[model samples]
Target chain A: MRQDIIEIRWHGRGGQGAITAAKVVANAVFKAGYKGVVMAPTFGTERRGAPVFTSLKISREKIYDLSPIETPDMVVVLDHTLLEEVDVTHGLKDGGQIILNTPKAIDTYDFGAHKLSISDVTSHALEAGLAPGIVNTGIIGAFAKATGLVSRDLLREAILNEFSVMKPEENARAAALTYDRTVIGGA
Target chain B: MHVIESGNVAAATGVKLARTQVIAAYPITPQTPLTEKLSEFVESGDLPAEYIPVESEHSAMAVCIASSTAGARSFTATSANGLLYMNEQLHWAAGARLPIVMCVANRGVGAPWTVWNDHQDTVSQRDLGWIQLYCADHQQIHDTVLKAFKLAETVSIPVMVCYDGYLLSHTYMPFDVPEQEKVDAFLPGFEPTHFLNPEKPRNFNTVTLPDVRPDLHGNTAPGYMEIRKTLHTDLRAALSEIEKIDGEFGEIFGRGGEPFLEPYCCDDADYVAFCMGSLSYQLRDVVDAMREEGIKVGVMGLKVYRPFPDAAVREALSAFKGVIVLEKALSYGNQGALYADVKSALYSAETRPFVHNYIVGLGGREIKTQHLYDALTESINKEAAVGDEPRWIGLKL
Candidate 1:
């Protein structure tokens, strides 16, 4: 793990748009002036409801290392059930952040020394007039609010850009609502 | 405009900016998105080109051959087994001297049924007489595709713009899309020297006798063997033309200079790691980490693989204390293809370095930075351990 690059691992199912969320975040961060940003989905035959993961790396300098991240600085879980299906906390650095899309309170789960942040992104998306289970864009809002690494406006802009032909306004609203509802807890 | 997008989109944008007239391809993983993007551009009327949804990779290349011979700037893309399926047309395309450009999202050849990134696909097609160019990142994928069209037209040869499948193809990164006007200025409209036209009817690649024969004008026409020799000679000569186009392209795009080889931290290093494609970029991080520990090592990426850049390779590697040739493809019975080539290139040099071969990331096996670091460290310390056989990394068996 290079000290200069921040590595993030994203967990979700095949059709949950985890890979799309990773790309949107990479775009937002790059536009926010991070010179180097890379997002790569796990390579394989992906089936619906199958456990899958993707990685995102961001840095101020150019990134030449394309190897899979063995130890990530943060872990983002798009579904709370993924915590049981997969070891979402594996290879997470001590005191690293775990941003989860869950309706439960942060203290409900014990993640050891890692910081925990929870947001009901699925609920937020549904409340914002989006179709059921469309929480990929809303999850970015939770990431932004929890880490404060990227601004909300930039995330909204990226969301709109990604979903321009689709429900762009609904996606942006879902992200905004999630951003306001994200709760950050100490390690 | 600079934007973060998939490498497939980057390649599509380059093809659009080049104003390609015809595109025909069969969908293959890692390469399907590139053609899909081009099809979108065509359907949306963004790019005015004929999009042919061919049934197979063979037909895809045949369409390019027919279109290119008719003086159309043609393009296509494919992956591992798909590329192998077009083997016959690939030879015909080069032998007939059609200036078509194809993008190969390099993938592992299948037997156990895996669609993953590896160099086995293009490396196996080394002798098919196509000018092969490897890219290390998304920007290079865009830039090289544009340059491939120009270089192919200049030499009257087909070109394969190759980058690692899934590694570069599916990854999202930032790359600048050069303006259409700038690309047009760099690459003029396709005016082929010889083409199939109703005004000037002539046969191309017709059968000839074994020896020299007289033509209609009583001049000696080259026989079959002579034609092959000419194709060989011209392909070798195109190496210099490649350098020239690279120089001119750099002057226009602000991203050239290293036409055949892109070196990093090799100015005063004793050891150099050599490979093709994005693996070279990955080794750059290893080189930097090793340099921190007072190891004088660097990395050199071989961008142009066909016509074998022997001179540039010899010149860059002859002065090093050691050279590690790490690659994804092997020659099966002998050693790594790149390792064999590098050794042969340095054979005639006055001073040769200790070159070792390492095979890694076959069939999309995970390539860890730690594995690379350990391999390099061992190669540096235990030079006595070097042998004719290539060492395999991450081989659980």
Candidate 2:
């Protein structure tokens, strides 16, 4: 019911860009001159493919608590496999949104969320010759479309700043395509 | 400014003034107050530091060592089982030569779980290469902490400023908390004598051959020395540094003292009860009480433990007819640790008298004046019977 800054949770394998998404979100928010905190809960000598979560809280005021997010306004899944294995929707409040980077339709799985959506990011990533990990950028784009928590311009600025080594146009084009394919309403 | 505070609070105040950048701690009985005060400081923003709330003492020490290597002045306080749990990281902190300062509110390491004061916690860590300092009171507790940071950073060694649980850790006494500005002038920006900087990366603790290991170990190397010999030499040198630093500290912060060794009634006394930590305060009173009864009892408190002040011990105890080594911890293969060391120092002396090792207050057991008095009488009456062997006191099954 809060109409202020949105808190999002990212779910993915340790090597995936879930923590990067959270940090980018925080950097984007901080650049926008709002207070934000990005926290990642990593455990037990995490290896390349171990499950990990990164949480983000964007607020107008300073953030004090470092606890994991029990309830989130939005959830971004970098890997669809985590949905069945882990409770990705566990803390999503009513009217919250879920953005997935899978090629399938949103109705295929039973998920608890006010809005559910899937993007053709994997195919787009493979076709573009970018790594499979680039699906995170597509999901991030869909995140911006589903809930305007951050402006598209800010998201673009974050991606450019974070992925400075990569060609800026490649990530920006990926974000635009993801924004168009993402479904807005409940499944 | 001076205020009435417990020894635990005094150590916390020292940590605050020392401006420790990172503090990772989990609470244990006597050390709980120390971390609590630090938490309060972090909450009020009085100390601009990161206070990590760790789940266990092992993790607490791990985080502290990590933060210390990360170029942050780090600190933590723990007691008893907590210290034992952090045993692994304790060695790592020292071997890595990270200047991590820890306040070990000394309690008996246990399976029979006790919450009282003892030396067992620190006794277990004696071989871990940490420069350990024992404090007799609140003022010493404060001063020792300030000195620990300098000494640790100076020698690129970790230091544990230990005090008795419940006794000094909780007992209230007036102590002068040095002004932050003054302490800052004395101990500036912590330009570590050595550190882990990525700019010019150099591997620390690299493996060496038997040819070079002799030089690697002890009172020989510039900053590195043989582990055991360095522990001894650094501790002795620490006394002079303690005096010099305290003198500078007094000039800057307007507070100082003979922070290493405190002697009472030893000038003309025939017998002296040698102890450390807050128990020395009780022994001081006992010494006064016994003196009134014509016992000529003296008390010598070893404020610094690691540097086993051999010269100080021989000079102080050599003149006495009865020197009782009151220890709160036991040595597994031998007698009391400090007692054995003190006795060994007097081995070459011609005029040294009877030296008795008495192990009291294990598992946080309370060491009462009556218990101490009884132990003394037994030692005196037995004369030569109390020889070099250790005597265990107050173990009721």
Candidate 3:
């Protein structure tokens, strides 16, 4: 009963695709045979460049709570700069996980009592010719591999379902590259 | 027959399945997507309807009333001040008794200004005379709209399908989008009880003296008092009809339950939390956690807020040791509107438990489950007393 629901919160700028990514993850996870997946994109008054938060709840049982995620199991950030401005780790579980879009060494940052996973998500998305600031898919790939919340293949399908890429192979390669390059360890 | 989408799209899907012929819309906040999706359906030739893009919410509802008067199944969507802008016409539709269906993506009314979620906008218009139904999730949002059309047309009363602005409107979940044929079978075509037919011209509600009045044709019609009383009588009768329609809806769509009060885990509950819309979902989680901790607690969700389900409220709360009213809305000088009705419901009941109102999440402040958990624990341990003042739960004061 304790782990019946896994709540994930995404922190990104308003123009960023975290909101879409959250919905994609919800679609992906549900299609992958999970039950009662709920995704909520925060409808704040904030405009572009301002921080926006989105939440997802995956549960085998029907999820009743439709409120904001006060306590999330995992926190995913699209921009590494947001780590300083926003409380990226706010209200996360005791041993919760944090997946960040960064290329720095894991030991350089310290998030006590929570596990951390890192990838150069923005670089991968930019390298793949995906729109800048839309690093959600790249980090989502890092997220799937780091937490095993969803499979790598389904995440790619979800991404492809969302965007009809011109160089589609690079899109798949972007996810695979981020997935393979993700580093998981101490917070 | 199934789809994963936001609650707004679910409502639009219901509008499509109900075969709404005329849709009048002026986009507002969370409700914008609802009309947007319907417009897309019309533009895409998927939903065969005339989509009227109006300039304001007042005109939007006016257009709906006009369409319904012309004997067409009409639909519209609005929120917050947009709802308030249509205040006078809301009464007009009710008085005229047009079976127009509307989707109110409930949000906090503005002064300080907010685009976030709450129930204040819809609850404040309680006396505007509509069959108000609050939905708990995306699926219910879709289901209730279908039921709203059926219930509204059955009784010739307007119905508003309400849900928390962004909480349900923007949230995504898997829902069984009912078969179009099945919905078509369940909901019959719009048969207007009273309509404006140009062939038969007559003035409506122009004037009525205190006594019975005779028309040009020597037919007697009741006065204002009886007309007002009859509307309420028919509305009260609509409460029962809603249950019947719900049963028939279940037979066809297999998605029917109690259309009034939904009591959960309350056989021997020491406390039962009462709420409406998505907030109640959070309260349900708290109830389960409390139950797991050996505390007997449950939740009672309000499906139909209008016609005030007094008997059901009395029966549900009389068994619990205490009743906690969780409201995302307030009545200014008074407490939550639900708190007032709940207090009145228990006043005549044989048993009176401790009753309190936790006015949480007003103006879209985030209401976590722990805040509700703390409030419930406090209410259960306190006296079996009732008060006019509500404890402002989670307010920074």
Candidate 4:
């Protein structure tokens, strides 16, 4: 891995829109002038409610490697329930950031030597009048606040662009609300 | 306009820009989104073309053949078993000399039934007489598709633009979509020399005797063997046309130069990694790592596969000390198809490099950079002693 590249792994259920979320972030960051951005979903046979993951990589130069990211700088959990069955932190870097869409407090989880951020994105999505448990856009707000890789405005714009026909304003609002409610904890 | 989109959307955008007259495709995994997007484009009036929702891949191809034979520019797409189902139509499209274009989201075939990325589908159809072009990224997916229409129309042979099923098809990346006017300038309307006309009814692909015979007007016509020979000769001639069209595309779009082979850092290296599709791009990372460790290595991507580009392959690779041929498909019992081709191409060269084959990532298996690095390093260390037997990487049998 290049030192300048930031790799992220997103964990969620098959129907939970993790792949779309990664794509949104990739779009936002690419608009932010990171020239190289790639988002790839786990290949083959994804069933709804079954655990699925997608990887995103961003860098200044063009990225040629299409291989899955073995060690990610950040791990995003779209559904906290996935944490029990899936080790979302399997190959996370030592000081990596872990963002979770959980109702629990950040201190309740102990990920050694890494930063933690928590946002109840499911609640945020509901509050924003989105479908129940559609926390994909909301999690992007937490990601923006925790890593500062992309701006909230840019993410909101990307969400609107991606969901233009399906409640674009509501998804942008969900992302904004989740961004404000995201709590970041020290390593 | 610059946008971040999937490789399928990129291909569809190219089709729309080319102003395709008709599109007929059956829904299949990976390739479904491309045709679905094309349907959306047609329904939304973003593209004024006829969109046919066919029952099966065979019917989809049949629609293309019929439409193309009527002098309408047509397109279709398929993958895995879907491509296999259209095997007979594939040859018919070529032999009948229809200028149709199809995109193959390359996937592994099955009795095991897998919907994953591999080259088995297209590689198995290598002899079916379609011009095969492989894309390594989203931009190439868009660019190659646009170029394929021109090449196919120029040679009167159907073209298949193939890219890895999930790797490139599903992944989202940034690519510049060329302006419609510019694309129009680069590729003109399809004007076939001969097409079906209702006023003057003619027979196409009718059964013929083994020996040459005279037609109703006493004009001598070619026999079956001669017709087959013409197709072979024309396919060989299309190689230069491919290069010329690519050069013209580059002049207009400013994004192409290497038409047949896209070589990265091979000018000063002694060893090069060779493959088709995304694997060649993936090996770039391994090449970088090896370069840092004092190993002179580069990677070359075979963009045009069917014409084989034997002369180009020999010319580019003859200077290297070793060529590591990594592929996602195999010939089952013999060896990697690309490995055999590389060796055969290098057979007449005064100095032949040690060519080794490593089959990797069949059935969507994870292809790690570390494994590729290890394989290339081992091959380089052993040099000519790396034997002729094809090696398997990341195997856990």
Clashes of each: 0, 4, 1, 0
User: Per-residue alpha-carbon lDDT of model 1 for B1-397, expressed as tens digits?
Assistant: 8988888888999999999999999999989899999999999999999999999999999999999999999999999999999999999999999999999999999897779999999999999889999999999999999999999999999999999998999988899998888899899999999999989998887877899998899999988888888888988998999999888888898988898999999999999999999999888888888999999999999999998889999999999999999999999999999999999999999999998989999999988887888888888886536578899988999
Compute each candidate's TM-score over C-alphas: 0.98, 0.63, 0.93, 0.98
Query: What TM-score would candidate 4 get against the native?
Result: 0.98
lDDT of 4 by residue, B35-96 (tens): 88999999999999999999999999999999998889999999999999999999999999
lDDT of 2 by residue, A82-180 (tens): 777888888688878888777677678666546777787777656545666677666777787887766788988887876788866677667767777
Q: What is the TM-score of chain A in candidate 3?
A: 0.92
lDDT of each: 0.92, 0.75, 0.86, 0.93
Q: Candidate 4: where is the Cα deviation over 4 Å?
A: B383-386
| Model 2 per-residue lDDT tens digits across residues B1-397 | 6454557889999999998899999999879989999999999999999999999999999998878877889999999899999999998887777889999998876677777767888987888878788887677889889888987877667899999776667544456786788778877666765567888686665664333232434533333445445555665576666567767766776555655567888889888888877667667656766776788888888877775667767877898897888998888778898888888989988898788889887765656666777788777776536446688878787
Residue A131 CA error for candidate 1 (Å)? Answer: 0.7
- What's the candidate order when arranged by decreasing TM-score? 1, 4, 3, 2
Residue B129 lDDT in candidate 3: 76
Better of 1 and 4 by TM-score: 1
Q: Tell me the tens digit of each residue's lDDT in model 4 across A1-187.
A: 4677899999999999998899899999998989999888888779999999999999988888877888999999999999899999999999999999999988899999988999999999999999998999999999999999999889988999999999999999999999999999999
What CAPRI grade goes to candidate 4?
Answer: medium
Q: Given the true complex, what DockQ would model 3 score?
A: 0.61
Error of 3 at B189 (Å): 2.3
True contacts kept of 1: 0.77
